[model samples]
Target: MTEAHAGFAPTGACWICGGERLRPVTRAIFEFSAYAQQDPELARYTGATVEIVRCRGCGFAQPAALPSLPDYFERMYDQRWSDEWMEAEFRDGTKDLIFREVVARLSDRVPARRRTLLDLGAHVGRLIQLAAEAGWRAEGVELNPRTSAYAARATGLPVHRADLRDLEAQGRRYAAVTLIDVLEHIPRPVEALLGVKRVLEPGGWIAVKVPHGPHQLMKERIRGRVVPGYRPTVADNLVHVSHFTAGSLRMALERAGYVDVSITTAAPVLPPPGQGAARAGRVAVRRGMTAAARVLPFGVRTPLAMNLQAYARAFV
Candidate 1:
């Protein structure tokens, strides 16, 4: 295992299965300093050769080296969560739709006498608000001081500036835990899932949404061939430390003492793929494909969909 940068170091074993054997899938020298700009002096020392590696045993692929959680959120992931981004997110309805799907899946399995929901990485508490609308007493846990305060004020919910490990330490428990596009960002996913299990009440459920890794790899490969150093364009390589497949996600949950893990595809509401004279035609084609995907069985849709979710129940 090779270190990509001075700060970023490779995990000796697989993050999902703890397997020792890993093979390189693709290699890209990630320039963290160039996240927002391409600085000539800063780019030289900051460039890290990131190799996307896969477990020989479990087929899970992730970066060879990645920054720790604290370093990433504070320094690297500097895209301002501005008001414009919030308005766009609301307009897009992507987050709301994902929350609805998660809520629907967990509604039936919620533990008796447990009506509370804890949302990890709940930026601005939008999902917390939605969970409240679904009749759960929802509160959020965020790590960013600014977002946590803003969310608490904006939504009038208990948005604490803390991590899941901190919540676990305080002996808090919830009937449902939601992590929308969050698991992939963690440096040690197995440890994080273990913490999630500890914070969950018996028979509680965890609903998670993550980018489909295989799809992302394919997209990146296509783009990288035409444009050099194209990996940064896709946000996953920049922020997401771990890239998950369906098998790896289920295995991680089960290893953390969760049972009855179910992985499903989250339907796509993406914009049209082209422009110009045939713009309307492209939109119709995209809509038709999305409709067909929705009707298809899980086995068929799991690979084609852009995103996937895992629903796991804590039996311990």
Candidate 2:
């Protein structure tokens, strides 16, 4: 693994809209040493800092500086997990609400005959399994060899360890594709989306879920103020490289040639194990927020829309 201590450079253009009207939103010291504790690959850049900037034109936020190392993201995400932990993750139902919602929505949009689905970044193949159970001929594209192999073994499905371009080159097409919690990690979201468009069948639907960047930031700020000795981790180490508002996300899909776009509040990942009452209360509050956001006019602009879910079709 290559070290990137002083290898940060400015991303001069906005990732979503390609605009130069960017203003700094926040700056934080990214302690690579702390991350290195999990993945020793980052042991080189022990002390580093980066600025996150928001694009005035598109309401999208991104790290002002990108690592000079081209494979920085790959190295950063190359996590080594024990099989025990992976197994636990595979069995975790905390994300079942999200997976079920996506699968149900995709099923409703695509006809039964054209129910072939591809889950991009299918971590551990949980979504693939659920989609399969839902009667979709589901498969996945996962780059990590460990997770891809695990997913294939666990689900008895072909989890391709290839990039979207590679899959596109193979002439594979699907009725639907999903990018749950995936797009925000990519710096060039529109370019990646265009690649997704090539792998879809004509008029194929795409389901995307991403955190509402501005609202999430506000929540974190409030939490930090309320909780003593708390620190915000939303943009830590630029893990979430692209922060998107609902408008920006819809615009990104449209710019990538997707039509019939619809954006709404997405389901939340259930909180980790805790007291039954507290967990239920949190889930109830989150579900209520999502339900309310679905009905409210201009809901995407409200703070209740903490996460954005979008359904769009590739141009016919």
Candidate 3:
């Protein structure tokens, strides 16, 4: 069962571990009025809210409240890519490479002939497709009606076009599950994982991936001196709601009844690592840096944490 609280707060104790050593790391203020004045849904927001709590014991940075469910997903959930870009970035080859590793590792965690794998918040079923090829019964969930239909049609797999909140009522369970870059968007990750746990067989694994803050770089156009500790003055649809250090992530999984957890730093192909990092006047230099990232050994590549890929098995 999930407990209702006034949102994770300063001096409010850690939500994952119940430790009280909380700290205020940074403050974020949102002003939706300019955008809200034009949009109907945006008007519901309380406007600007200050985020001021961090847990020193577990390194979990919890905001008071997150963007409402619809506002977070409906309007901001556009995964559009241009044609040429899609050709280069959306290759099944890239996806297969990533999923193959997970499937192989997960297979060792459990043994069965026809294993079932459910992908929460699956987009286009790319991962499911790869898992299917690796000899598992793969399926996915999508909120977008059109994309879910397309995924079902393309891959010949069942894709539930619904949210995780409603999944239990549908009578679902799986041998393995995945949530790639999906945890940050939800208003409540704990409840979300509880739902995930409900659907997985005991001893099965849930593999998770999310963007590590250290690796994302955005150029700031400014008029003065550049220094350390510079974050974007504002955040938008792409804003990260929950931020987790390795410790916070481990605690989250531990609380969810997952044992023998491990987090690995995996390199996610940056679609066009070259194009995004390229500068107007310094193409050659930037390309070199991008290539370096490709071969760079996985370690604390600072300013960007290696994209957080966590693997945990359900407790036996």
Give lDDT for model 2: 0.88
State the C-alpha lDDT per candidate: 0.72, 0.88, 0.62
Query: Which ranges in model 3 have alpha carbons more than 4 Å from their true place?
Result: 1-13, 29-38, 43-49, 67-97, 163-170, 213-238, 273-304
Query: Which of candidates 1 and 2 reaches a greater lDDT?
Result: 2
lDDT of 1 at 122: 87
Judging by lDDT, tell me the better candidate of 2 and 3.
2
Which window of 10 residues has the lowest lDDT sum in candidate 3? 216-225
| Candidate 2 ranges with C-alpha deviation above 4 Å | 1-6, 34-41
Candidates 1 and 3 compared by TM-score, better number:
1
Whose lDDT is greatest here? 2
| RMSD of each predicted structure | 4.7, 2.4, 6.9
Task: Encode model 2's per-residue lDDT on 1-316: one tens digit a residue.
Answer: 5654647788889988898999988765665665756655465655677889999999999999887755888877887778987787898667889899999998889989889999999989999999999999999999888888899999999899988778889989999999999999998899989989888999999999999998988999999999999886688767898899988999999999999999988998888665689998998999899888889998878999999999999999
TM-score of each: 0.81, 0.94, 0.71
| Candidate 2: residue 74 Cα off by (Å) | 0.5
* Number of the top TM-score candidate: 2
lDDT of 3 by residue, 1-316 (tens): 3222222233355666677776655556554455444544543443445563566776565564555435445654544434444344335344454567777777777676748999887666777888888788999998766567666866799899876556656777788899877786654466667778877877878988765532432232131127566544322332555556666777788888889888765434333334444533354543345345445664424333445668888888
